[model samples]
Target: MRRRPQKPRPTGASQYRINHQIRIPQIRVIGPEGDQLGIMSPDEARDIAVEAGLDLVEVAPTAKPPVCRIMDYGKFRYEQSKKVSSARSARVEIKTLRMRPKTDTHDMETITRKARSFLEKGDKVRFVMRLRGREQAHISLWITKLNAMVETLNDIATVIQTPRIEGRMITATIEPNNSSSQSSSSSSSSAPSTTTSSSSS
Candidate 1:
């Protein structure tokens, strides 16, 4: 018998596990403000949502006991739909930097500079390192290199998709770190600038 083709991973609005779709007996819950509300029965979580006049949504299904949050389902769906639509019209730029395994430090420096530029522009960066011959033998070493390179950009960027070995290529993606930028602005505004002066009697 031929193996049945796997169903395409669910995408878009239908992927959301909200309210009755969350069947787990117990799950971790979070309040609307992103605070942990601890673990509770699904029914209990639903009651909390009901009291709060919101919807209980399973945000992280794969986590231990899963994680559900009290949110406005209608708003969530609207935002999700808008994300798909806006993302298309956003004209987001993605630049892929191709390299070979065991890339030299000089080459890495160049790649880092390019990645930083793309991220600073609010563009995405995809790192693809092709392996040839025996270079593919030590995949771990290449992954370590990719991870290190990602860390160097962490202050300005955040990983959307972690590096992975796909056949002969290691691939990863990163986008501008908006939260970092916001935090930096806040920090600058709060910086101490007032100087104390002493007077002699």
Candidate 2:
């Protein structure tokens, strides 16, 4: 009977070939504590890993001779998952709040509170105002409301884009005020004033 070809391994930062799954003939080995073990056949690498009670993992498969490391595979996988999670949480996102030209004071206040919360969390806020039918004719009303909203958030946010009408919507963008404040502080600190004293001969 003809032998079936092995399935290709999955490729990602989290994927790795361990122990018997490593099918290469020769590999460069790294010990459990990260010391180099020189070049060896797969069988020899596996033996060393077994003796040390760890896994032989193909860490750098694209090298001249594949590089394998001896470590606790379970712990390595757990750490990799944590790194991915940390990266995802660190990403900044743009959050949006919708309003209408006729939005009441109470409703606008509620929306503004939500927007402030988003800004405090280091996210950009996009304020969108929708107009319907005859409301589109009075775009200035929406612009006025947007400007007022920007003023309310001035303490924690800086206007990135002024209100502009787009189709039936008016949009404005704002970012965390700390960015502007930090830049201004840095600029002021870098340009210190100098005083010159004249001496009489």
Per-prediction TM-score, please? 0.45, 0.56
User: Residue by residue across 72-163, what tens digits does model 2's lDDT show?
Assistant: 77778779779877655445467778877888888888888888988897667888888889998888877988899889999999997999
Q: What RMSD, rounded to one decimal, does every model reach?
A: 20.3, 15.2
Candidate 2 versus truth, CA RMSD in Å, comes to: 15.2
* Global fold similarity of model 2 (TM-score): 0.56
For model 1, give the 10-residue run with minimal summed lDDT: 192-201
**Candidate that scores best on TM-score:** 2
Residue-pair clashes per candidate: 0, 0
Error of 1 at 190 (Å): 37
The positional error of residue 3 in candidate 1, measured at the CA in angstroms, is: 77
lDDT string for model 1 (141-192, tens) is 9999989999999889988789998888888987788733443444454431
